[model samples]
Target: MPFVIAVLLAADAVSLMAAGDRAFAARDFRAALFAYQDLTREDPGSASVWVRLGETYARMGHDLEAGESFSRALRLNGKNASAKEGLAASRERLAILSPPPKPVVDEAGARERYTAAVRMINERNYRDALNALDEALRKRPGYAVALVARGSARMGLLDYDAAAADYSAARGSDPSLASPLFGLAEAYRALGQPAKAAQLYRAYAESPATDVQPALKEYALRNAQSLGSQ
Candidate 1:
């Protein structure tokens, strides 16, 4: 009877997961949320389920709930990649939602904020660095240096999507900045989008303006080879 009960529970979980996937594919995040939430109730220890729930919450713009879900997933499996990504993204969104300090309004003030963020990054305090970068950007929306710095901080936290956005924005705001190419490639790699990463890495490797280091080029080339389209 115990064996039969175990089999029944496993089958139910599988059914729930299948339903959740279908809902997610259809872009009905609320349905996905319901299915994943039920799955967690039935199998509270499933780390992947918590990660899925976190992702769904993030998609629905509930940053607080998303963070909580990611936290649960991390508690279950400290090394869960999806949970780590979700947690970092959630943290950024929560910070963005908060009220910003009075605008610094001066280039020198923005530079000061950016320098403070750099110090935070050096200390490995990524979250505080993000806050500082956010303030810097608010003071100077087109500050390419601050954008790149913020992207670096996000990358350290494994928040690949946000990092990619920051890099892309920096590149757009200042076309002369070749540094964003390398940072953008790294973000794509972390997000498991190897094709985009490889393409950008190859561009950086081939560009004379950006190819300041041969070792970095070799490293990028090897990564592209390892993560081929096949």
Candidate 2:
């Protein structure tokens, strides 16, 4: 009975996907959006459906919504090229609306993109935030905050290798910033470099995180003592 139900659901998904494709090809994006929305609810694990939904939102000039969908798709399957492209495009589209980079300390374009990335992160749309931070780093290669945020997003995506690299760069660039210390420690632990992680956790525990996130300082203090003991 379960096997028959699965087959029936799959067939329904196929039929709905065909309808969405037709609507998309005809440029009836509203219809396509509706179809894809239904499909996403019916087949929530389908990365392709989420990607199609994102594409429809993009065509409608709803970059934020598009980004959310693309991020969800990537969460389900990070290797989905269409979802990756859609996420990047969504970030780029929003970045274009802001003023151009100023060539000074606060490059306006980079700041805009970085802010967009933060907004996405706050929404738990880590993939979109990662894409935006990548764009921000391209604009300002030395943006430590963007690097740190990218590390956090990569950590969310379970890309520990990239996360470690980004956190290390950010930590090297600005040793005073406390947030990256915790994040770097986290990445190192994930990568099986417990010694490196423990050191950074100690640093994080000693930093002035009480001014911003006292909870982080306490968490770091625990990790600093626990990683070595374990």
Candidate 3:
């Protein structure tokens, strides 16, 4: 009777582990979360189970829970790369959600703000241009042109990292767009990453022709400098 009982428990454990793995493989994150949660409750010593739970929480956007799960997994297995990566990503998402407060504006105000940003950029007022762009983004998220303009303004201010992020955001909004790629190449050049700058410049050069010749020329000059510096 005791042997039968032990066999039944072992079978149940195997079933639970298989269910968790199946849910994770299907990318059914919520289901994976539930399955892993149950498995962890039954087998708290399983480091792989904790890591899988963390990944599911991360995929579901439960950053705090994900961080905790990853921390637990790391405690169980210090060399777990997926757990470490999930923890880092969750922390980053939490940081973004709780970024320092800035002045807010409405939708119409965002258009006005972007117009002001453009005017300021034209006048070489880099600081004010960025501030205006920030205001615009607060009201209308994912404004690609505003992001590109902000990147250009940041380049003028020599803030290469922020410029790169803005240009990247712009490109993400429109992958085939050349302007953001040019901006990214210029930013990479400023940051002294010549190889990456050259690659981006090549991408921009091969992009479809638009009224972007002037920007392309600017990128070409930076790419030349990057190559010469190498």
| Candidate 2 vs 3: which has more lDDT | 2
Model 2, 140-175: lDDT tens digits are 888989998999899989999999889889879887
* TM-score ranking from best candidate downward: 2, 1, 3
Q: In angstroms, give how far residue 81 of model 1 lies from its true place.
A: 67
Q: In model 2, which residue pairs have backbone atoms overlapping below 3 Å?
A: none
Clashing pairs in 3: none
Model 2 residue 63 distance off true place after TM-score fit, in angstroms: 52
Query: Per model, how many backbone clashes are there?
Result: 0, 0, 0
Residue 121 displacement (Å), model 1? 1.3
Scanning candidate 3 in windows of ten residues, the lowest lDDT window is 209-218
For residues 87-199, could you state the per-residue lDDT of candidate 3 as single tens digits? 89999999999968764547788889999999999999999999999989888887788899999999989999999999999989867577898888889988988888888
Which ranges in model 3 have alpha carbons more than 4 Å from their true place?
Answer: 1-108, 209-211, 214-229
**Candidate 1, residues 110-204: lDDT per residue as tens digits?**
89999999999999999999999998988887899899999999999989899999999998998776678888989998998889888888777
| TM-score for each candidate, following the candidate numbering | 0.50, 0.51, 0.49
Give the whole-model CA lDDT for all candidates, comma-separated: 0.90, 0.90, 0.85
Q: Could you give the C-alpha RMSD of every candidate to the true structure, in order shown?
A: 20.9, 22.6, 13.9
